[model samples]
Target chain A: MKVTWSRRHVLETDDWSREEIEHVLDTANGMLEVLSRPIRRAPPLRGRTVILFFAEASTRTRVSFELAAKALSADVVNITATGSSVEKGESLLDTARTLEALGGDVLVIRHGSSGAPYFVAQRVGAAVINAGDGAHAHPTQGLLDAYTLRAKLGDLAGKRIVVVGDVLHSRVARSDINALVPLGARVTLSGPPTLLPAAWRCGDLPSGVGYEPDVDRALDGADGVIALRLQRERQEAGLLPSIREYARTWGLTEPRVATMRPGAPVMHPGPMNEGVEIDAAVAHGARSLIEEQVTNGVAVRMALLYLLIAGGEPRLIVGAEPPTSIAGGEPPATPLPTGVV
Target chain B: MTTFDRRALEAAGYLVVPGFIDLHVHLREPGFEDSETIASGARAALRGGFTTVCAMPNTEPAIDSPGLIAELVARAKAANAARVLPVATITRGRKGKELADLVELAAAGAVAFSDDGSPVDDARLFRSALEYARAADRPVLEHPQDLALSARGVMHEGRVSADLGLPGIPAAAEEAAIARDLALAKLSGARLHLQHVSTARSVELVRRAKADGLAVTCEVTPHHLALTDAWVAGDRTVAWEGRPSPRATPFDASTKVNPPLRTEGDVRALWDALADGTIDAIATDHAPHASVKKDVEYDLAAFGISGLETALPLLLGGVDAGWAALDTVIAALTTGPARVLGIDVPDDDWTVVDRAATWIVTAAGLASKGKNTPLLGRELRGRVVMSVVGGDVRYEGDLRAAPLAVR
Candidate 1:
């Protein structure tokens, strides 16, 4: 069931085949070993150029992907069109194409549009990596998640992963779900209704994507918890409600961590308002995989870059796994009917 | 038969009705036993007073071929309890792929056709299924889900799911599939039977489709017609029994079935559909998963519970709960399902002494295998004292088991 990683859509995890998921996971693991070597690491993207264009403001993602590219010896260029052409009114597609025309070898992008990466991937000849996109997906986040889970659980096939926080708003959790699913893990996404995405999209979530809303409920037998940092900017932009109430209801505390299945790791796509999205104590706890996730980001991205350069011929060498099928994973979920987003 | 006195039956308010029928039941004969076996399941069906049950085709090996349909017919007749009408898979192996041998399956006693637990995603494939069903003069029952819309949702997507934090199975998921099926059915001139519709909007869709002159009929599961995702609120912990339910509460793993349970508004709509003639029949979707498979973590629990034993009492209990009329309720259990399955069981073929037979029963007394009954300890308004299918008294709880006179 291992499939080729066609740079089409990063909308959901199943967008890639189980083979692709495994390839990414194994490559990430290999990168982990490569990072741990006395040599530290070899530059995989020695001559490549990685362009980071984030429409939405970010500190962790921009840094992680940027650092990832830098660690791979790639030339990195960062762009935040927030105050640029976007303020003056420029479409996202045009912006992506503009980046493509500028000799961008790899477009590591995060946008407000769900399928922005896929659009750019199709339009440009360069390899496209989704940094994060409009409440839709963050492919590298998912890759790092798979890396973190593999580090803790060793294998993902039978592991139970619970992703908690603003699912409707966090591009991190959405993409994490997309990655975890194809990696042969039982992934559940939970959050308040305001943050919950279309349930139907998760129903037939192509690769074992399970949906839960209650964080406590989703956390019961969970082997890992990926707490999404509810974007504070989302509240300012009115994508979410009050932050204090959100923290009170969704904040992962040490006590809550104690209640999780033993040794269950916790993760956050960082630059977290520590006590707001997750308790500072739990964020620093033994089970906290946030730091490890950052470390794996460079590795996961190295694998993605390696895969892009190697193309179809050497993908099989990365150890692709079998795909897990579910009655769910049905997609094209009933869209809100209005393309208003 | 353990004979019981008529006095005891009458005291329970049980009465005699014409044979009862269920349009949806998965016997799991050709394949899949981690879930159910035909014999044990059929025994439960007989105990539930179902003289007939239409078994679905989404089994392990799948029942898309005429040979599988023929095998099902032989097995059911051999059991000689409930008449098992086979619903062959509309597509090969129910992948929603290519069309199957509809004519062959129909000729070999497939009363209907369906992918059952899945919607035929391909429009051309679905249209072909309808065309084949129309040509064979059979209904293609479908578990409609607009894959895209129904994704991510682990339960009925709405206020309760949001409040409980369970991924909601949006009303549009059901609507999208049903709408597409209706359109295809209309275009292909096919008789389309929708299975396990769980939303009020679905009722509206079916109602509108029927009004538009589309030959569409729909069935509602008892779970959907009764419970909602709110059941998880009583113990939000149930949502995480590790499984996600897009339709009903992840209550008892054994109770998990798809086109999952809906909200109270959905329940009202189902009842309203029955009352207004929008819902065509009452089907059990009598899925029986082993205790181990269903008792696992909610996410791991098999997505089905056995309902053959409770269909009648549950319908009658709906009356007790002020959800249906006496005649309408029995009609749903008996004539409604029979008609939906394309069977014509007449009153003259059997005997109906009383329609208001009371069934005061405990879950322990019901012969269903899986202990996933959401209706345990509830009283029902009517009971089938005798189920005489085709002139054979297949069931007689407290009444006489007489030979059915129907030819």
Candidate 2:
């Protein structure tokens, strides 16, 4: 299959094609090569400006995107919600437009509201990347996790991966399914009955995914695992009894890790709730890919910025098409009109 | 009443029905004026062929006192289009605790009592309100919802909402609340009107309650009858599939509403209820919110569609599609709603609709201040060409001059 890139927004992963997923993986491999060299820098985006418009607090997503942009030799500016015009009664659209007016060529937004980046992308000419929206998509994170799993396990096809924790509130869980399911991997979500409720399982579990309340049952023979952050507020909201109870029932302990295929690799989109969702020893264990996921995060984002920004030219890449589209076996997408970029 | 020549009216493709009486509408006056004023909402209602519209009481100060009801009555009369009858809040500030003076409010020209936007959750308080309403000779309309159950849900709890990744507001939230309200109404023998029945279970509940001889009635919105949550989850291309266009989230925010649009099964049940006379009336629930309020994310955006200008024609479209007989739908919009609020259906007031005519709904063309309709750009049939209230022509549409003297 030969495909060209011209799209300008990175929102949810629900519509990604297998070919597109592989395309990002292939591109991230190249980015990893660039990161390996001493004094690493890429000049494809040297003259462009990347703006980080974060309306929510973050440590990993913010720093990784900043480093990725800087490594591409692009000028980067960071804006936060508090102590800014956003606090002085400026609307999300107005703030987005103001950033575009300030010569931002790429906008990376992490808003507290879902679909905020999609809203901005429709109005502005700049490239929009959703850093993380409220329980919505986090596309870049989805891509990096897939890349990490593929790198470690060789292929994601036919693999069983259990995503355990507050799948309801985790945007990471949404993104992971979007990325993993299309690649022929079976994903099961496991957590307390409150966090992994019946609604998530019944309506739209995307064909390749299922949910299990028993963490032990879900992790049985699983090839990989992604543990999500469990906010202490869940207990206060009566979704759980207490953090200690959660860790005992649902937390990924070393014993639980042993139940999976040997060296199955555990991953977390980190700032881990160490005792709550995963144990410290398990996080630092031999099968843990937590640190590698952080490293791959930069590579994956670099690949995304390249494809969305630098790969807008009328060049085609020859590759074998993935078996399915992002919507799980939907037909290959209709290409955008010529010279859209 | 002025009678038109039958041949001339038939040549013009016009069908005259008694002017519509809407049982529920949020005029947003005395608060949130930027979204809509009483004058603006009434004019919009008149344009849609409505003669009388019951204004909901969920406002800034709320319509709890006789003085507040009197002020609204005066404001509606001064507006001078559709008659705006006040629906006073059942509780002071709609706090769901203390009951309001229902007797005095009815005397002060409040036709009904309701906390239409917020539910009166307490069973004890709701029972007290219903008992008082019986004495006042007014119906008590309740926006039924188990708040704790529907806590953070943004849309209908179903497959569409699940696919869209929004928190689901289960149908049980409405079913549980209505069950409680019906039990109280049965116990108290009060006139109870269920506001915006959205699910199949709700329609069945209302039907059973009426059969059991309880004084209960319910209204369904045009959007709910015409659309389902599938429309709310429109086609989308995921980000990884390539570049995700802004067009991805097109229907997400606009289709959001209270008692959110349910399933196709529910839509079928509503049509069946309307046809079988189980549902009482068709109300716009014509809630108008400013663009700034609705253009945000689904959870953050207000729950409403500015519906006054589009309701009649949309229901008429349902008629044309064989969803219901024309007369039955007309009754739901006119005499049926008038009876719900005990308003007299005057023979002198009527609107002439061009059943064969078609027009696209647009924000710039509507009389209401709110432009948040989901029906924007839809080419719909059955336009109200001219409306007459109290023998006065309130709205004359483009086809008025081409009339073979429609009214």
Name the best candidate (by lDDT).
2
- Window of ten residues with lowest summed lDDT in model 2 chain B: B236-245
lDDT of 2 at B215: 91
Query: Residue-wise lDDT of candidate 2 within B138-173, one digit each (tens)?
Result: 999889999999998888876665555578799999
lDDT of 2 at A280: 94
Candidate 1 segments exceeding 4 Å error: A1-194, A197-341, B1-14, B235-251, B346-364, B376-382, B398-407
Assess each model's interface with DockQ, reporting 2 decimals per model: 0.03, 0.36
Best by DockQ: 2
Which ranges of candidate 2 are over 4 A from the true structure? Answer: A312-341, B1-7, B235-252, B400-407
TM-score of each: 0.54, 0.92
RMSD of each: 20.1, 5.8
Q: How big is the positional error of residue A20 in model 1, measured in Å on the Cα after superposition?
A: 50
lDDT of 2 at A65: 93
